[model samples]
Target: MLIEVEVCDVCRRLGVPVTSYTITETESGRSVVTVRCGEHAAPFEEVLGQPVEAVAAAETPKPRQAKKAATGRQPRGQRAERQVMTREQIDAAKAAGKA
Candidate 1:
């Protein structure tokens, strides 16, 4: 005999299809089943007050550093308000190769 399983309650409420699921028994001996796609399972675990297990312990990639300007000068508007430099002064320093 073929058994038909219902789509995940959370995903169905959110208008999505069921692809993954978890069955849990409450303290009161009531068995509750939750169905969700892989993407929604984490949130479902939070709703069910269960700890979500990591599928794979992949290392997170390090964040990339911002590239420096070709002229070796700090970008404008990023400086502190007390250390403002005028365009003319900056141009003079660049021309004198002191920037």
Candidate 2:
């Protein structure tokens, strides 16, 4: 038996994972593709002169998100908008020498 199997349109276009394939043997003596799901039953005929069955099952890889840029510098703006530190706070920090 000779059959042609390709990536299903729904699976390819809609980005659906083709973990399982739904095949129906029609009266026309040709295998027709119906759908592809996450899992399916088997009775698949290995067609002659066709590509070997895929060893790896279809699965949707996890989507990757782009990383954000690091920021260490302060934004440019008016100095008046910045809060003023108290003299006591500055003195205490200087005395402790932590900053």
Candidate 3:
């Protein structure tokens, strides 16, 4: 089951996953719930002027996916065969070009 989970708003800025933190609500007309890592609770409160709700346990974010392997190599084919020209044929072509 896919559940919508809240991650640490602060840690998310750094693209890191945090599992433990305290939750707090932002003090504004539009109330927003901001989750913070263990160390960010005080900062969030001080910055957002919000009060802490409670400390809770959150699941660690799933590991980032690895870069996908390259698709199949570019298609290739054998070069077309070249015409076999003798010295006489070459001289004839050169002579024709001079005409």
lDDT of 1 by residue, 1-99 (tens): 997765655555544556555465657676655567656686555555643343222234568998776586668657645767899999998999999
lDDT of 2 by residue, 1-99 (tens): 997554444444344444444455556666655554333222233232334444222233568997554476444542336667899988998999965
Stretches of candidate 1 off by over 4 Å are: 1-5, 11-20, 23-33, 37-59, 76-99
Preferred candidate (TM-score higher): 1 or 3: 1
* TM-scores for the candidates: 0.27, 0.20, 0.25
Q: Give candidate 2's total backbone clashes.
A: 0
> lDDT scores for all predictions?
0.62, 0.49, 0.56
RMSD after CA superposition, every candidate? 10.4, 15.7, 18.0
Name the top lDDT candidate: 1
**Tens-digit lDDT track for model 3 on 1-99?**
896665666665444444453344556545445566556666544544533332221223557987654466433453546889888988998999942
Clash count, predicted structure 1: 0
User: Candidate 1: worst 10 consecutive residues by lDDT?
Assistant: 50-59
lDDT of 3 at 78: 35
Model 3 residue 55 CA deviation (Å) reads 22
